[model samples]
Structure formats: structure tokens, C-alpha cells
Target: MPSRFRAWELCALMLAVGSAFTSNFAGADEKAEGDIPAFVGKDSPVGAWEYGKERGEFWKYRNEKPTATIDASSVGKYADKLTPGQIALFKAKPGYRMEIYPAHRVCGVPDFVAANSEQNKTLAKLDASEEHVVDGVTPGVMFPQPKTGAQAIYNYLLRYRGVGTSVSAQVTAVSPRPGSDEWITAVGPSLNYYPWAVEGHNKVVGGGAILNGISFTYVSPAALAGQGGAGKIYFNQDAEAYYYFTGQRRVRRMPSYLYDAPQLGYENEYLVDETGVFLGPPIDRFNWKLVGKKELYVPYSSFGMYRFNAKFDSVFSKSFVNPEFRRYEPHRVYVVEATLKPDARHVAHKKVFYLDEDTWIPVLAEDYDAQGNLWKVKEAYPIPVWELGGTCDFLAFTQYDMATGRYVSDQTTIGQGKDVRWFAKATEPWMKSDYFTSQALQSRSDR
Candidate 1:
């Protein structure tokens, strides 16, 4: 089961990173940045100033390691701004289901067609009585509100899927296309247990425990290939923690593996790259900045699910790992771009993230190449709602290589539900460092 129980919250107090009591946090005004406390006397192995140390488990895993610590208090500070409904939703025990659908009906105008002599002559003289108007209007002109990548997904979850304040299931099925795998099914137990799985490389690679309706899994790229492998992860249910039997090595949740750095506006954490590689150590560091927001059209948005899913072989090759080959300056968020300090470690070229500010979620990301060219583009959209409140971060995404016209998309499916206790009990024998090796994955059952 993927642990999505606000893991940052649990670790917040220890690292003093996400404490709501702190002043400098997300959504806070820029002026407040100056008033933030510095990392002077904290016992963090990775001080705020020395965030991106090039040594430690984090370094070995991420290769570059984190250059700075993230401010833990920031989580609480920003979380406070959430509406009561949003807060309740975030804290809800019921799992959530997310889905994505591609809408066909491209641009058109029914009224325009009806008034156009050319269109009426063609239709009236032909046996196309089966054709309908645009949204009930004659000639069927489409409304301008093109279903955006995120909105297309959100609407399906809220409307067709029956996702709301209560539990429900929704259809997330899509026709199997030519390029990618076919659509899969998922069900949640009591709106809390959500099952999201991914079939990659002609193999079932990503899926995990759906305990008490909430769990998360980060399948390794190796597993995505249907190869015998796993990924490192963080998960919780019913107040207990369980480390997944997979992921890149060197991930940990202990104080020794943790660091604090108020100076960086971050605390109590290590950093990892897209491949599940950790980027920082107990002694690494980097500088943090909250760049302004921007709207963007990311590639592989849900709108193209139907057409793109069928074009898999044409887009990706077995050797493709970010074949898009992008880079960045500071940091790389899935969708939201954040700039990093020049001296930062483990980060690609300077980058920008197209994150959904409303959900603090990312949808599309762009990476620069060594030459600072727009080498790669990664796009993701939310899945439909069946469980887990029907609202999720992203259902799937595709990374594209503009130079070679090659790409790879990771589509996902939710899984069956389970009890929260299942996760709590599972956590009893787990350790943060256990995920760093292949032997650790083999020993999960015994643990």
C-alpha cells in the first residue's frame, strides 16, 4: 500500500519542518521570508546551510544528493490556509480513487454549421440523420471551454464517478488504443481503500496495499519494466507506518537520516530525484525560493488518453528513461517548477514545474538539456474518482523527446480496498533504512 497519510505531517514535529506553529511556510507572503528563523543550533545532521552534501545514503541513492534541507514547519503553515472542507478531505480516513478520460469531439460549432449553406446542403442531401447537434444545439457547435488536462480529469471524478463527501465508485474505463496498454479497473472499500496499479512493459509493475482506503506505492523503474525488482517508499494507515518492499536504496525516516535547515526554509528531510534516488544526506543542503505561479499546457494530458494510449510502441523504447532528456537549473517538480541554488546538488539543469497551486499538486514538468534547450517534456493528469475521494494528484503522465519524437507514458489503475489496521500492523517490523537493498525487499515477509 502506498503511504499517503500526509507523511510530511508525522515527520514535521521531529524536524520542526512542517510545524503549523512556524511562520515561514507555503502560501505565506514573501515579506515573511526575511523573518524566518535561521538554522543555527538545531541538531540536524544536515544543517540548513550545508544541505547538499555529496555523501551519505541520500547521495549514493540520488547520485547528486540534496543541497539543502526543506523547512518542515512550512507544511503546517501552508496547510492552515486550506478550507475546512479541504482540510477534512485531506484528513479523511476513506481512501480515494482517481481516473482520467480522453474527450473526443474536437473543435466545432453546430449553430455555425446549421446556418452555413454549405454544411446544410452536404448534410441534408446525405443520409447522416444519425449525426447530432453540438451539445443539443443544431449543427453542434462546441463551447469554447476546451476540457483542460486537469479539469477534464476533475470533472469526471466529481460528476460521473460519484466522488464527494461520501463513498462511491465511478467508471474509469477507456478503450484500449494502438500505442499503449488497455484500460484497467479499480475499486475502493468505503471510499478510503483505493487501488491504483500500473501495467508497464507488458507486465503488472505498479500496485500496492489499499489499507483502510489509503495507501500509496512508488514502483521502481525496474519494476515498471516487469523486471524482478521493487522500490523504496513511505506509507501509513491507522497511525502506523510500513515501508514498501521496493524503491531506490538509501531512503530513511530516522533522525540520523533526517536534517533541518530553517535558513533554506526547509527542515527534517532528504531529497530524491525522479528515479527514486535520494539527493541529500544528514549533512547536505541547498537554498529554497518560491517562484511565482504560471499556467501551462503539459504534454500527455488526459485529453489524449484515447489516442495516445494506443500509440505506445511508436512513442517509447525499452531503453527510454526520460528519453525526453531534459535538464534544469534548480529543482524539478513533477509539474511545479522551483529554482534551486547554483551550488545545489543532484538537480538537473534549471527547471520549471507546472503545479496545480490549488491542490499543491503538479501536472506537467519541463526540463532543460545541458545546452539549456527544451529537451524533454513530462505531462500528467488526474485519474477518475472511484475511491480516495475521487480527487488525486495525477493518474498518469508521458515524457516526450522532441528531438527523436520518442516518448513514454505511465498509466495507472486503482486497486481493491483494505482495512487501516492492515497498514498499522505491517508497520510494526518495518524500518526506514530497510528499503536500500535488494536483500531488504526479499526479507519483507519475515519482517
Candidate 2:
């Protein structure tokens, strides 16, 4: 996913005279254009981009309302197999469809087991040591109990939608640590969707080359909401490229903003290893479970009843990720789970995620401790804006300690406005690495 700040920096430079962002494709399906409303940009805050009211309205206008009712009993005939009810649901949503088949029987393989063979052998040797060791008389901190094997069930399903690669993430606690406030930030070349933090100068910086090596950026402030100047932000790549915002309004022009739908991985299994590095290969080896469909009120995006209880694993019956003895409620999205290759660097033993079906967005995630307990829970959401084509322009994501109250949430893409020319020519010369490096920032001193 393009960095939120990088997109903002590019959006700032493309200042067109009028409010309407011109169509990228001439004769671009008037139907597609018609599907979206006109000139909603001027009335919106500059940096608000994650899908919001404007895009939501377009979705509502273009697509027919789905019949919200479903026959529960008939859902089973297609539980492991595609049934007629499942087909009906898919037909109701535009640009959407469903692929239902036997969970483990598809490739003529036996059902995928969450807590069977290999996983136990691998997890058996982990140090079942204490959660934490404290100084002097204070008792050592006890981390949350390890996750039950159920998370493996969750991963087996979510992997089907993602590139199934090792995504990058960082957990941050407040300055003092273990307080009421915290944050978390996760980024990939193709997507950036996280939860908003209530307060703080939670900032994150990251970017890479676009078409022709034009680099990008992302940033946020300590406190959001009503704060006046804290969120001040901008992007500059020489005279040909200038993108910045005075408070909320944008001023400048440059190409290489987001909305380009850049690819993050080379193939389904390879993380795009060019400018940005993939931690590892695609997460393809797994036993999967397609739990039919259901309705879930996830963080940012909401859709009609869709697939539910999707789960998966790394290789075969091994379950070393979320551990086998942890107890979690059924309603909690703890079922969606995955494990990095045992040897992959910076990976949690098992990571369980609660995902939104429509957008393939992860609302919450559970990172496991060495002993397989719920180490941290990560949350994410985006700010809605029009100039960004009615998508989230800002994103805030946080990770909290499940046992202790410590946590951290990084905020990125927090600014406003747009330059039409820069947006249209997104993916250009100025957005390269030399323009945004530390040497560049240190050499020039003016905003």
C-alpha cells in the first residue's frame, strides 16, 4: 500500500483550477463515472481519504440494496459446499462474488485440523516460563494466557484473501509505558488501513519508489481531533514537485500520489522485492476452512452477511502460532489465524486477525507471545476524505498489551487538500528516494 503521507504529499501538488478531478480514462465508462457523483472534493477536508460518506453514497446509489434476510437452515447444504442461498447473496452485491467449496476436501485432501499432529510437536518445546520477571519485591508481570488453537482455524481462511506473505508491523506504548494511551502501525506496499488513536503525536514515516522510482511518504501527529497546528504536514521533491498543507488546505503540485493500485507482491506468493522488501514468500501452505457466510460489524467497512469463520495454518497439522491452551470467547474474531515460517524473522509465533470481508481489511489482530499467549492486540481505521476519491486520507492503528495496560498507536496521512495536476500525473520524477532522504530534509529548512 502507498504510504498515506506519500499520497498526501503527491495530492498536495496536483492543484487543478476546478473542484472536479478529471477522469483518468477518456471514454472511461460513463457508467463508472455515473456510478460516482461529481465534484464532491471542494466541500470535504483535504486529507480525509479512507472510504467515507461520499463513496458510501456512491455505493448506495450505484448498487441495489441487498435483501438482508437469509435462511439459516439452508446455509448448511452449502456449509462445506456451495449452496443456492450462497449464490443469492453474491448476486445481490455489485463488484462482489462468492467462491464456496469443501474446506479440506477440495484437493481431495482430508479436513484441515487446527490442533493436530505437527503443531503440537513444534510448540511442545517453547519455554513455558513466567510472563515477566519484575525487580525486587514487585511480582513478575503475567502475560495473558496463550491463545487456544482456535486461531489456527481463523488463519486457514483469511490467507485465501491476502497475498499470504509476512506483513510489517510495529507496536508502540505511551512514553511512560503501560498507561491508558498507546498505538500500533503496520505498513505494506499495497495497503495501509489502521485504527485511529484518541490522542498523541503518534507519527510514522515510510515510503518507496513508484513508476520510475518516484518515492512516497506517510506521517501523523500526537493529538488529532481539535488540535490546531500539530498535524501540519507536507512533501517536496525539488521545484518540479511541491506538496504541503497550511493546517488543512493543500498548496503545491507533483505526480506519484496513491490511487494507482500499485502491486505489493510480484506473484501471489512473492512479496514485491524491488524497492520495498517482502519479509518472506506468499503464505500458501495451509489447511483451510470456508465457514459459509455471516454478517460482521467490522471497523471501517461494512457489508452484508458474507463468509465467516475462515481459518488456515502454515504447513500441515502444526499449530505453534497462537498456542493450544488459551481460552477466548466464540464471538471474538480470534478464529482468524496464521503463523510465519518458523524461521522467518520478526514474526510472532501465530497471529490471529479479525478481518472485514468486503474490503479485506483487518480491524483487529492478536500477536502471540513466545509461549503462545495473546501478546498484543492491534486495531486500525481510516479517516474519510473526498479529494482522495472518497477514501480514507488518514489512518491510525494501535497495539495494546493484553495483560498489562501498555500500548502504542501510530498515526499517518494526517493533512488536507489536493492539486489536480499532481494527482493526475501521479507516479513521476520528484517522488524518488534522494528527494525524501535525511540528507534532503537536513539541507533545506523552509516549508
Candidate 3:
């Protein structure tokens, strides 16, 4: 096994322009794209050129959805082998079909578990809505043995991801037109700071209500370039989000920015809470129910999605991300179903999430409309962040608009020369608290 790679420094910046990225293929020794060496995890089964494994004629299906028929005759044999959402997806007949791979263990953070053990000597309960953690919150998994759906989701959402992560470049793409080989892409840099998620520290640092603070600046698509802002994910309340508009030259609070709000770019393909499947506050408008566990083919060890040297043409298909570059392992996942409350409102009336049992990171999520029709399906690619003591994180994810066949993919280093920088400690200047405020957001805008 390869040794864990060290965290990259913040100085290894990617130029704000999309043209600054390179698309040429790389060899086995394609290390150190900039000041810091790129990482593919210690236990990853591939080299720098994971894209070399793509099959011949795979590109032939670019203009169409999955050609294979999936019905009672085809799905009968595997009916019991997959989740209801996965089954529903099969019926939807996507361009890419499911491919199951061998299961493996995804590493977890040691200090996080240690801190979780120390801080949660007495586990706490959720608030009246059973969404927010009322007490006993710490850096690691919020609920080790979660009996409720809310607790399981809390475990998935609050898992320690080092102090935070500094993304060098995450490219988001909305699927292109049929027979037209063009993609609408966005390039950006993101900073996430966990106020109380610092490792080796058992107690909360900042207010626990504010779990994480994140800021983003996009540098591509000229119209929105140099625009950025910051926000905080609260424990019980809606997030506090602010955006600094380069055109306006001012910072404005996004009062209604949380949940189902379409992102600024991507032609309404990306939503505010769609990233990572669910970045919304826990105590929002859903009533969560523990749906037990199931063995499903979930994305795991997705080194192909992290191919900083691979071209976007190799991964971004018309309807969905190229299935050849995606890997699915058969593992037990904690299934949770969330439904809109009696008086609640949102675009998605129902949401179901499949979280990896070991790492607690959600691998697949399905959203339903008010009439119980499958609306959107999302999948996240998990790669071990070896620098953070072999802990796991999802830097690549995609959401498919089931209705229009349009899809939005993001948090990827694919085709970019640099990779997302993971930090085991909060040492960067941007990871501080004040930087996430609206005032700091205005001063920090790239304009």
C-alpha cells in the first residue's frame, strides 16, 4: 500500500480562468502538479491514470440514455438485491447502468472517534423536531448507534473532515445537448471551516449552533467570475448566507438561500441543498424515519472521478456522468426516509438517503415530488483523505434531473491540474471565524 500523502499548501492556486486547467492525460508518476503533491489515497487501487481503464466503444452511448431494457423480466432476478430507489432508477432507464464491485473498508478519522468518545460520554437527544442535536455534539459522528433517522443523518452530516478543506478547483458541469459535444462548466475555489470540528479537542470551540462556515469564489464564465461570498450552517436555524456580487460591488444577505433554492449558475440545475445530497440544517422541514439498513451498490473508492489529469470529455456524458469512471461497492448502508411535514414547503416533497455504515458519508440520495414521483437522483464519490489520518471525504458528486434529463456535477478536480487540499489542522488564514461573516465576504471577494 502507498503511504498517506501530506496535505497540500494553500499557495498552490489554480488560475481563476477555465483556460488555466489542462486536459492532457498523465502517466503513473504524475505527482506534484504544483507546490504540493496530488493525492490518490494510500489504499487506492489505481495510479495517476485511472482513466486508462475505460472500455472501448463506451463513448458510443453519449447521445442516448442507457440502452438496456429494465422491466419486470430484467429486474426480477435482482429485485431483492437493491434498494427501492435504486430499483426506481433502473426503471427510469438512465444512460448508464449499475455495476457492482467488491466491498471494502473505508477508513475513518481516529482523532474524530476519540473526540466523539470523550465528548459524548452522555449522548443527547434531538430537539422537538428531532432534527437538531440539542446537546452532546462533538467533532466526530454525532450518533454512534443511532436508533432514529435524524440521528443517522446527523452522523452522516457532522462527521469530522479534518479542520476543513480548501478546494483548489472544483469543476461543475451541466449536461450538454444531444449530439452537441459541449458542456456548461463552472470553475471555483471553496473554503470550509469547522468551528468545533478540530481534532484532539473534545469540547466545542465556537458556538455549536454554527457547525461550519463556507465561502466560495467562482473564477469562470466571465459573467459571474470574481463573485463570491460566505455562509454558516446552523444546527437548528436556517443557514446565514451572503453573496458578494461583482456587478453590484456589494455584499447582500441571502435571506431565503437554504433548501431548494436554485444556484446562481448551472441554468437551475444545481440547488442550494443539493451539494453532498443534503447540506441543509437538520431541523428543517422534514420528518425523518429510520428505514433500517440495506446492502446496495454505492459509489466507493472513486479514484476515477479524482483524476486531475483526465479530461472532462472522458467523464461528463450527456445525461449522467460516464458510468465507466464510476465504481460501486456492495456495502451495508443505513437507509433513512425524510418526508415534508404537514405545513412544510419545498420543491422536493420527499427525500431518501443511503449512508455508508462505516464512514457515515451519504453515497446515494433520491428526491421525490409532491405526487411521489422520482424527481432527482444524486450520487457522491468517496475517496480517503490520507492526510487526515486516512479519513474519508467526498470531493466529487453529481445530481441528475430525472425529469429533463439534465444533470449537474461538481466538487471535482477532473481535467484540472491541481487537486482539492485537505488539512488535518486549521492552519490557513481563511479557516478563521470572522472570514465567514458578510463583512469579511465583501472584503474577500476576488473583485
Residue pairs with colliding backbones in model 3 are 65-95, 66-94, 66-95
Across 1-447, the per-residue lDDT of candidate 2 in tens digits comes to 122224342234233212222221111121212112221221233234333223333322223332222234344443432222223323332222222111100000001111111122232221222111111100000111123332232222211111111112211113222332222222211121111110111111212211122222223232321111101012111112333333443434433222111222111111111111111112222222223223232233221100011122210012111111111111112234555445444324655555332222344455665677665555444222233333222133434445443433332211121111112112434333354333343233133
Over 1-447, each residue of candidate 1 has an lDDT whose tens digit, in order, gives 222324343344224422221210122221212222221111112223221221122211123322222122222443432222222222331231122112111111111221221222222220122111111111111111112322211111111111111112211222233365533222221112212111000111122222112222322223321112223222111112223333343223322222221111011111223211111111122222335443222221132232222333432333232222111112111132333346654334544445432222344555554566564455444322212222223434444444433344433221211111111112222322344334553454233
Candidate 2 yields a Cα-based lDDT of 0.25
What is candidate 1's CA lDDT for residue 84?
A: 25
Candidate 1 accuracy as TM-score: 0.33
Highest TM-score: which candidate?
3
Ranking by lDDT: 3, 1, 2
Scored by lDDT, model 1 comes in at 0.26
Please list the residue runs of candidate 2 whose C-alpha ends up more than 4 Å from where it truly belongs after superposition.
1-175, 178-294, 301-336, 392-394, 412-430, 436-447
TM-score of each: 0.33, 0.32, 0.80
Indicate the residue-level lDDT of 103 in model 1. 18
Ranking by TM-score: 3, 1, 2
Query: In model 3, how many backbone clashes occur?
Result: 3
| Highest-lDDT candidate | 3
What does the lDDT come to for candidate 3? 0.68
